[model samples]
Target: MKVQVKSFFSVLSGGKPVVRTLDLQEGTTAEDAMKLMKVDFSDGAIILINGRPSNEKSVLSEGDFFVVMPPVSAA
Candidate 1:
């Protein structure tokens, strides 16, 4: 199964977009994909599965879309 992963930051920063397509086996967890992408969840990153908040261990299915966002703060 193939999943689309998208990472976006605020538009004000004008940073490069982070996006990738990953091929994973059935029963792959969100944590597994994160590891494959070398993303550390502990860095205040939030994961959403199909537009809903999901935990690292949440199981993923075919055509799953993951949106990862960094923590927001007020300066």
Candidate 2:
């Protein structure tokens, strides 16, 4: 199964799209995908799977899209 991953910051930068297609086996979780990317999300970061808030253990499926965003604040 192939899953799509994207980062919010990359989209804001207008840089090369952060979207990536990965071939994962069955029963892969969000944490598993993060590990594959070697990303250690900060405590203040928010994770969304297919537009809904999700956690590390959330399971993923083919064609699933994830968006990772850091907490934003205003002074």
Best by lDDT: 1
lDDT of 1 by residue, 1-75 (tens): 999988764332676657899999999998888878766667666889999998888898999999777766789
Best by TM-score: 1
Note the residue pairs that clash in candidate 2.
none
Supply candidate 2's per-residue lDDT for 22: 83
lDDT of 2 by residue, 1-75 (tens): 998887655544575546778899999998888777555565545779999999888999988998766567787
TM-score of each: 0.78, 0.74
Error of 2 at 46 (Å): 1.2
Q: Which 10-residue window in model 1 sums to the lowest lDDT?
A: 8-17
Segments of candidate 2 deviating more than 4 angstroms = 9-17, 42-44, 72-75
Q: What is the lDDT of residue 53 in candidate 2?
A: 96
